[model samples]
Target: MDAPYGQLIEAEPGVARLLAPNPTPYTFTGTQVHLVGRDELAVIDPGPADAAHIDALVRAIGGRPVAAILVTHTHKDHSPGARPLSATTGAPVVGCAPLVIEGGTEAGFDHLYAPDRVLADGESVVVDSRTLTAVHTPGHTSNHLCFADEAAGILFSGDHVMGWSTSVVIPPDGDMGDYVRSLEKLRGRTQDRIYYPAHGEPVAEPQRLVRGMIGHRLQRERQILRRVEAGDRTVERIVAAAYPGLDPRLVPAAGASVLAHLLELAKRGLVSHADEQWSATA
Candidate 1:
């Protein structure tokens, strides 16, 4: 936030970030492009395919060799620049499996994302002096990933865990159960001291924040259940009851999250739906 757009500002000894100018209600200030090495860098989350943003990224590179362009997921705001940036720097695009969910384009997914090499869970790519291991976290999207520099105790937590707001789990491709499980996965990583999320500032106390996030999600689940108990059957009614006075622009996303919760509840047999109406199960 302190750093202006398009400038690479160092966060730690070797970690730096460049903020893209694509801010929105969902994207926070912008999509943060993290550079993971001092010399031969691994660019994480190249952001939108804006010509200006790509040029800014190239300028930030400053002729240094880019080992790889790592994308956390194929969200339009997060991965569209990878192709153009890779073409410009000769760096191979990597990380996260390719996914194209129909009817998801309007929801911000970039269906055209094609990684040069898909890094499986726990698979790693070595940069100049850093090794970033891909942690498959399927919540924000089915292919979302968080890169971990274990030696440095730094995690580039993409949309999975951000400081600004809880990730909106759109159903079908996004799962609430998987989102909670992913939060639990991060919570168990005791060694990850700091987290550089795709939005907001760095998380200095990742574990503490992660624990709180887990509790927040659980509380949301309870709220949804309460709404259902109170005769809020459809996702629209549940959202209206659970998130009163929400911004009209964000209502659709909120409805999506509510549906994700209801789907998860249905999976656990705590709720059941018939003809678009949901009810608490025995």
Candidate 2:
């Protein structure tokens, strides 16, 4: 599965991956577009709207008729190539419901995804032999979805849950409460043993990783509470206190995460948030 455009990981039956050539600080090893099926295929998350990557994707399909275009979310590195690829392969674009920004969206979110068929949670689509059941795990964004292969017990966990870095909780487009709750949602489902993430390598212990993610969020909440109680009012100060030695590049993301936690805490009556600041509910 050697690809000249991007690297290819060893895939199992009915699945192959083509990493997009758009590697950056955000996208660890470039965005991975998964090709699922035997002869005919379903291409998922066709990376950035780059011609080379699209050509690579079409080439990888190797004359196989593409039946479906599945996208997990609408990040710039994830779904921008859907339309062009659709034109090339004539496969209908289908994945998570279109972008619905709640509070606000970050700089890099792809808002142009037009799905031919809107999919909901538990809605399943069969492309060749693979039947991917959409699992609405909205946290990274309002419409993030994770597709599951129920029979094989494998999950295509998008940026909602990744193996490389903890998914950034960018509010108000991203919600910590929803993110934490989604982590809890996956924690109980012990059926999925492996997860194929969009950016990094595949994870074998999805349950353990998900459980750890849940615990990490809760622990982060506690740390944020402690920081707020210790007289850190602003999100920046709280983030500094909560993440003492965080990488400078990730400080902004950490601040957003802390803000999301504070907002969620305010909603739960555990903290008071007002005027661009947060405080302990004394």
Candidate 3:
């Protein structure tokens, strides 16, 4: 049966998983997480504020004590339900601070999160017999976090990593440099064999997936540079040329990705910008 968000694909025993009903240009899929253990189970990324979805999650957990509600970031589709769920279950909400972009408002973050527990990089939350370690992998959003479960050997990688699509790097909320670094950090980790991303199925070979993501970004950057060499100076023009066949609806997102790449390229001195136009510098 198909849910409103996307098809549900169960991964790893003891974990109740469901996809949200709403899929959009922005949210490829919605993920509901339920972690069951002895003392008190927890839910991560409880999905949107939909009552039915939240109800489905509550039903799935079946009166099991909800230990905590964890959020990866403050994106609307991801964190808006934390307050209601916390109130319903009396579970403490936990997450990093909402990402604040310089000279810009907190676009989609939830100021209402008011996490009872705030996670730090490398911090771990012990539930029953499992340990969920928080890895601050900022890139998709500055406050993003990935939870590594030592016992399950899995990583609940919010938007930091995905099985089907590349994560968007929209600045000033996103940074390509930080994204690449976060990918590299994941590559260096030794424990995780499977990645339960915020969207799509569980990734069995995370190292391979990480390498592919890094390579794809690099390739896209090269294409953008080539576009610059061919006289497409503005981000809009470059994105049009490089992503010629992308859905029109996705062009705006593509522009954001191009902007992120351009920003990173500028930092490396490979490209320079003047008058809002990018040019190859080397």
Candidate 4:
């Protein structure tokens, strides 16, 4: 998807997006700041605290009364601009709970994200007469949320379900089991017709993609179990074996993901790690 940076492109009726110029391997074509509703807008995932991006958002809003500034998570790339945008438009910042996991700051978390209101799972916030329900789809982060506008059959899926790539689950806060369960939760909701992820193109067939994501995670679980059984007894070794010839820049993240999987497997008694060395238990 050739997302033009700083341009407000209409995704669907009453839904438009402006791409933030913060693209990277993890962020794909940068974070997509979604504007929902027509006259009264609700900004979702305001991206990084980039002055230019915030200026672009204010321009796109065009002095319209903003109902809310909704955030999916507290990731630095997804929520830092909420405060500035809210201040500019006088809209309340609301959505996912604020989180700052100790020792997890280096993971790109926005420690200063102080939401005006935290929406719990299944809770709906009315914006411009449209009810946007918050689905607490954790695992990408413990406080990650996916907002659903049931009336429009549109889901603003955050990093939980991205079209570009599977979400990386780093342990201590990120859990593979919870991530898979969240995927299943979305799969069960056949109502969401389209999903607009924060980082990539919209998913028209969210169910299919979600099912595939579940399968992929489970497949990775099996592969990791096999690797442990075969004496690939460390996260580094498991990452080397599972993600062969992976980019050097992403190796650390890959190792974290492997540890997450191993931790989940240990919970199920399928694998065990002692002294930082993993081994199959079953």
Candidate 1, 1-282: lDDT as tens digits: 553899999998889999999999999999999998887999999999999999999999999999999999998989999999999999999999888676645457887888899999999999997899999889889899999999999999999999788899997899999999999999999999999999999999999999999999899999999999988889998888888899999998999999999999999999999999999996
Residues 1-282, model 4: lDDT tens digits? 786889999988899999999988889999999999898999999999999999999999999999999999988899999989988989999999988676646557888889999999999888788999999898988999999999899999999998799888887888888988999999999999999999888999999999999998899889989999999999888899999889998997898888888999999999877799888887
Which of the numbered candidates is closest to the native, going by highest lDDT? Answer: 1
Colliding residue pairs in candidate 2: none
Candidate 2 per-residue lDDT, tens place, 160-273, comes to 887688998888778898998888888887899788889787889988888888888899999888888888989988877778898898888888888888889899888997
By descending lDDT, how would the candidates be arranged? 1, 4, 2, 3
Task: Report lDDT (Cα) of residue 142, candidate 2.
Answer: 81
The CA lDDT of each predicted structure is 0.92, 0.84, 0.81, 0.91
* Count of clashes, each model: 0, 0, 4, 0
CA lDDT, candidate 2, residue 56 = 74
Q: Write the per-residue lDDT of candidate 3 for residues 157-237, one digit (tens) a residue.
A: 988898678889888889999999999999998688988877776789999999999999999988998999888999889
TM-score of every model?
0.97, 0.95, 0.93, 0.97
| Better candidate number, 2 or 3, judged by lDDT | 2
Cα shift from native, residue 74, model 3 (Å): 1.1
Model 2 error, position 204 (Å): 0.4
